[model samples]
Target: MALASIPTKQYIEQREEGYWIKGSRVSLDSVVYSFLEGETPEVIAQNFPLLSLEQVYGAITFYLANREFVNTYLQNGEAEFGQLQKDCQQRSPQLYQLLMAGQARLSQAS
Candidate 1:
């Protein structure tokens, strides 16, 4: 007898950007990161109350099943986020410079 194939339904959803859990805006990365940080599934669910424990387990299963691909996708996403932050800072240089100046002042006061 053949084992049943995995169905992504009720567990994961593919968006334009990437995979997110069904019925919640939480990304699979949040789950994976928390898991990597040694957080339990229950704690992950608490960290993202919108996700149930079962969903957390399911996401972990998916990640385990496709660890390499998922890791690459996570890396690419981090790179993209870094680029976006660079673009935003470039677009609003003055705001960030002023914010940096305030932070420097606070650090000196401490």
Candidate 2:
């Protein structure tokens, strides 16, 4: 089947990554990114309570169908995250301190 033949309502285009998938209302990129970050499907589902197992699978299908685009997105995200970390360290020392403190707390909790 053609790409256009895919049902629109069943999917949504991720704004940051610009990819489409079923369940337009859901943030598939966020889900996929969480998975890439070593999060389990159950954890992801907990984060997105409205998402079903089938919908999560559909997001994976969408990612597989557009591997290059998703890979680029992941690459760009790392670059952007690095830039943001640098900027935050330079431009917002107090915020950086607060973030570090939060991270420390999280680590201790874990």
The top-ranked prediction according to lDDT is: 1
TM-score of 2: 0.69
In candidate 1, stretches whose alpha carbon ends up further than 4 angstroms from where it belongs are: 1-10, 98-110
Candidate 2 worst ten-residue window by lDDT = 5-14
Cα displacement (angstroms), candidate 2, residue 94, comes to 2.6
Count clashing residue pairs per candidate. Answer: 0, 6
CA error at residue 84 for candidate 1, angstroms = 0.9
Give candidate 2 misplaced runs (Cα > 4 Å): 1-10, 16-26, 37-43
lDDT per residue for candidate 1 within 1-110, as digits (tens), equals: 99899864558888987999988899999999999999999999899989989999999989999999999999999999889868877999998788778999999999
Alpha carbon lDDT at 38, candidate 1: 98
lDDT of each: 0.91, 0.74
